[model samples]
Each structure stands twice: as structure tokens, then as C-alpha cells.
Target: MKILQDFELLFQQELHKLYDNDEIKAIFLVVIAEKLGLNTANYQLSKKDPVDDKNSAEILSILRDLKKHKPIQYILNKADFYGEVFQVNESVLIPRQETEELVDLIIKNHKFSQNLNIIDIGTGSGCIPITLSKHLTNARVTTIDISKEAIKTAQENANILKTAVQFINADIFEWEYIFSNQHYHIIVSNPPYITPGEKKYMNENVLAYEPELALFIEESTPLIFYDVISSFALKHLAPDGDLYFEINQYLGAEMKDLMIKKGFEQVKLIKDINGADRIIHAKKAW
Candidate 1:
């Protein structure tokens, strides 16, 4: 029970029923790396070393939460996103790999531009805007969120990353009142696109542990966030600017059609690594 190897065995014994072998190992390794600062090589080298009573207590506490299907990131209060770690809580959704692709796409498309102005809607953990600010030093970034708690957590992340992303507490639906005349060269968002009906297909850990406010939309309005943000972009984006979104896989064609109907000069639907229709880029005409 005191040895690091014993803790690894404990994870397997406890979580084997809940997770597959690879998932169990990945979760155990992440917990060990963060909680004990041991990488896989070092973990293997020191697996038999006795852990202190305090560390053992902490591991047990985390294991208890894992039993309840709590996300490891929330249990540790941090998440890995776009090559950096961000603070996370139930108030905000954990960053995802699809979002990283969205950020990478923006960086690739805008890296050469000078003095870019970009804004991100729905700033959960501030990952999108903050990562953009870090990579695109010439850009001024603004991010908005409806939840004050999400803003607070995201602000902490921005501060930690030392990225100058302006965090605003506002609803995207009311952005016109807040930023009537201001224009951005790039507008991006990874807003809530999960329909309530789709919840049945998602894993229990996500459905039970993650924040519903940042995940689900009414089935009646599957495009609520996308509908509002993209429309707002048509008004607030500068001439020749671009709008980007991480979209629902099922609604890719519909989203592309919506962007085209909104009169974007060019609309490109891009797939994620998993080949899901995951991102959209809509360019405004000059």
C-alpha cells in the first residue's frame, strides 16, 4: 500500500471494471506523473519505492473520486491543452483534442499576418484565446464567457500562461451591445454544440462529471451557439476577416450551408484527426 507499484496495482484492481486496459494505464500514469512528478521511465525505475503517508493519502483520495467517474483533470484541477496545462473545475469544461486542432488551424492560417485582432467566444478555461495569444504574439485577443466562474478559471489560466488575452464576462448572444463598432480580423469559438439527445451515446465520465452548461444544448436548437456567434461575426469581423468554429460532427454539412448562406466569401469544412467533420473556416469578402 505504501509503495508506488502497489498504488499502480490498486488502480488496476479498482478501475479494471470501469475502464479498459489502455485507459487504466493512461489514467494511472497521468496521476502518477502529476501527483508524484514521475514520468513513465522514472515511474518504472521507482515503482517499488515507498510513498510517504501524505502522498498515499492523496492518491487514495483521488482513487475514491475516480470510482465515482470523476474526470482526472477535475480531480487534479488541471488539464493539458495545446501544449500547456490549464486550470479546470466543474464550472468549466476540460479542453479537448479537437479544440487543439482548431487552434492549430488558426495559427497556421494567421501566423504571417501583422497586428491581427482576434476574438474567441465561449471562453471555457480560455484555452483557445490564450493559446492563440501565446503563439501569435502580434495578435490582440479577446475571449468572452457567460459564466463568471468560467471566466475566473480562464483568467487564472491566462495569467499562468502569461498570455494577454482579454477575458470578458458576457453572453455571446448580446455581443452586439458590448462591441458594436469594434472589429476583429479573426473570430473563433468552440462553443457548446452537444444536443441533449446525444447524451445517451457519451461516456458516463463526461456526462456525469463535466459541466452541462458548457456541453449540452436544447435539442430544439442544436445550433444555438454557432447560430449566434457566426451571425455576430458577419457584423463584427473586419472586411476580409475570417471566422472559425469547432462544430458538431453530425451538423457539419448544415454548418457549412449556414456559413455559405450567411454570405461568407469562402467556407471550408475541415476534419479532425479522427476524420470527423470538426472545424469550419468562413472568410468574409473584401
Candidate 2:
């Protein structure tokens, strides 16, 4: 069996070939240390020291998975978002930094209230709704997803996180038929916005591993989810209720225009950490 020292050397060399991000390598190493029950602090202290045999074997196994393009979060089964650790798996899309920025924008701009009812459409892993519920304390939050696997994973996450978020398994297109009269104070979605034409440009890790339904929108109808959700908001959003979406970076202006055309007021597109137009916010007329 290889020792920890040997594993570290192998990790460094293999990671250098696989990932360009230095921080990703650091995180992968830390996860490996964590999985092996090694003293992470001590391991850091003795960076040059050889790892013991048992830890080295486990880490070597993990490295093999990583080389296969398995996401570290899926291998670890947990991810950190908005200062909280969340359970994650292949069943749900990994929580992303861009979505965190969307959540931050929502929290910063919206007033919290016990009676504020919020719905998060396409709620993968329940990240947005659960985080909003944790922060809002008394807000009534409901999350919906078309994928049964995603819904199940999201429900498990809610239970584990000890956050109260109502999970519903239903497609947004069928929402009106399923729950016609339901209205909310806030409606939010980070729907599948990647155009099908862009699939070739996405990394293999994402294209191969992440759920395609949660990633792609047909190039011909890129605004499919937006159109459906906006229609729902128009008919069901309480007067003066807000609608929020994490949108395709390349189509923010078009999204804003669509919202305005649908009778939404104050339609605005906001940039994310990468300075990409990433979120759209609008209010239903009272």
C-alpha cells in the first residue's frame, strides 16, 4: 500500500494535469484527507511528510475517481453554500457560486416576513428555498422540481439541514393545472437556461455528470421556462409580489424585455460575481 506521502505526490502530479484551478486541487486534497480520517491540520503542517498506508490507499482510490471526472462534492456527498454545508449527489445539480449570488441579491432586496410566501421553481437540492427559509425564519417556502430524483434529494437535504421547505414534485409547465389558484408573495427560479447549441462548449465534467434537464434549454425556445413561470406569476403572484430568476448570461436583455411585455414592472437584470448578466428581478403590478 502507498503511504500518505506518496499519495500526496501522486495527487499533485495528477491534479496538475486534470485541473487548471489551484484551489480545486487544494479542495480535493482536503477532501481526501477528510475521507481517510487523517488529522487534516497535522497533514497540512507536515505537508512534506509521508502519509500512513491506510490513508494512502483510500486517497489513491479517491484520486482514481477524480481522474474519471467525478465531482469532489459528489465523492464527498456534501457542499458548502452560503456558509452552510449541504448534502449533494449526482441526482441534483451542485450548488454553484452564481446561484449564491442570486440568493444574496434576493436577500438584500426583499423584506422578510412571517407571512411571506415564496416558491422556488426547479428547486434542485432545495438550495434556494432552504437557504431562504433559514434566513427568513418565518417565511413559508415551497420548492418544486420536475425530476423525481432531484425532489427526493432536495427533501433529504431539507431534513438533514433542519430547514422547513415544502418540496413538490411537478413540472413548472403543469403547475397551473396541478395547483391553479395558488399564489405567492415571491416567485424564484434558477431554471435550465443553457441553450442546446452551447452544449458542445460545456466542460465534460458538467456535460457528462450533471443532469441535462437541469442544464439545457432548447436553442429555439430558450425562454420556455421563463415564459411559463412568468405566466404563472402574472396569474398567481399576489399584487406587488416579486419574481426573480437566475438567467442565461447572454440573454439578460431579452429576458428583461419578455418580463416587461408580460406586464411585469421594474424588470431589471443584474450581474453576478463574474460580471456576467445573471439574474432578473421584477415586480407584479398591484
Candidate 3:
């Protein structure tokens, strides 16, 4: 069996073409640390130790999966969002850094507010609602997802994270009636906005490993979720309540117009680190 340091070199040699040198190194360290039951602090001291045969097999399997472009998060079955670690799997889309920005923006907007009611429409990994529940301490957070498997994964994350979020396993269209007489201080969604045609442009890691239902919108109705969720917010949002979305970068202008047409005020499109229009915010008139 190879020493841990040698496996690091192997990881770099095999993954260099697909990942940057820095990212590959980071992944290598994390995989070794997790696999060997060592934390970051002790990692350097253990690098020269020879890995046992069984552990070596697991490392080799991970390398093979990496070569196939499967995300490291899926391989590990865990993801970090905001400041919390969340369980993840093939059933749910991995929590993204861009979505963290969306959650942070909402927290900043309502940081001092209390007893708010917040409902998120897409409950992948329960990251959004769970993070909101943790930060906005007095808020009642509820989330919905169309996929039962996704809801199960999100619930598992919520339990693991020790956050209470009411989860609903229902399509937004079928479940609107359940909230007809209800109103919320905020409604948020990181819905499926990528059109079918855009799949070719997405990373193989995302397309091949992630759930398609959480990634693509129908080509004929590319903005289906945004349109429906924004319209739902029109009626279900409390007076002066806010609505937020993690949107397609290419569709920001269209999103702003749609929210305006839905009569939401103060519509704004915000850019992510890559300067892509990634989040949208709108407020209902008080």
C-alpha cells in the first residue's frame, strides 16, 4: 500500500486535467483526513503513514469517481453551506455557495426583525430554510419540494443540523391551496431555472451526478418556477413582505421584469462572485 503522501501525488496526477492544482490538493487533503480519521491539525504529521489495504481501496474508488466527474460532495455525501455541514446525496442538488449569498441577504434584511414567517419553495438539502431558521431565531421556517427523496434528504440534514423546519413534499402548484389563507414575511426559492437546452453548457459533474428535476426547467416554459413562485408570492406574501430567488444569471433581466409585473416593489437583481446576476429580491407594498 502507498503512503498517504504518495496517494496525494496520485490524486494530483489523475485529477489535474479536470480540476485546478489548488482544488485537487484541497480535495486530496480532505479525502485523506476524513478517510483516515484525522483532523486538519494532525494531517501533516500523518502524511507519511502507510494506508491499510481496505482504506486504500476506498481511496482508489474515490479517485475513479472523481475521474468520472462526480462531485466530491456527492462522493462524501456531505456539503457545507453557510457555516453548517449538510448531508447530501443523489436525491437532492448539492447546496451551493451562491445560495448561501441568497440566505445571507435575507438574514441581513431581517436580522433585527422577530417572529417572522418564512417559507422556501425548493427544499434541496434543507440548506436554505435550515440556515434561515438558525440565524433568524424567532422565525417560523417552512420548506417544500416536489421530490419525496429530496424531502427525505433535506429532513435528514435538518435533523442532523438540529434545526426545526416544517417540510412539505408537494409540488408548488398542488400545494398553493394549502397556504391560500396564509401569509409569510418572506418567500424564497432556488428553483429549477436552467432550460433543457442549457444542459450542454453545464459541468459534467452537475449533469451526470445531480438530480435533473432540481436542475432543469422545461424548455417551453423555462421560467416556470420563477413565474409561478413570484405569482404565488403576490397573494401569499404578507403585506410589505419580501420575496427572494437564486436565479439563472442569463435570466436576471427577465426575472426583474416578471417580479415587477407581479406587482412586487423594489425589485433588484444582485450579482455573485463571478459577476453573474445570481439573486433577485422584491418586496410587496405594505
What's each prediction's clash count?
Answer: 0, 3, 0
TM-score of 1: 0.96
74: Cα error in model 2, Å = 1.4
How much lDDT does candidate 2 score? 0.83
Off by over 4 Å in 1: none
Q: Regarding TM-score, does 1 or 2 come out ahead?
A: 1
lDDT of 2 by residue, 163-214 (tens): 8898889877766776677889889999999998898887777887888888
- How do all the candidates rank in terms of TM-score, highest first? 1, 3, 2
Model 1 pairs in collision: none
Clashing pairs in 3: none
lDDT of 1 by residue, 1-286 (tens): 4899998889999998789889989999999897899999999899889999989998999999999999899999999998898999999999999999999999998888878899999898989999999998578999999999999999999889888888899877766888887999999989999998898899889999888989988999998788888888878999889999999999999999888888887799999999999999988765
The true-versus-predicted C-alpha distance at residue 37 of model 1, in Å, is: 1.8
Off by over 4 Å in 2: 1-5, 36-42
Query: Per-residue lDDT for 172 in model 3?
Result: 88
lDDT score of residue 183 within candidate 3: 92
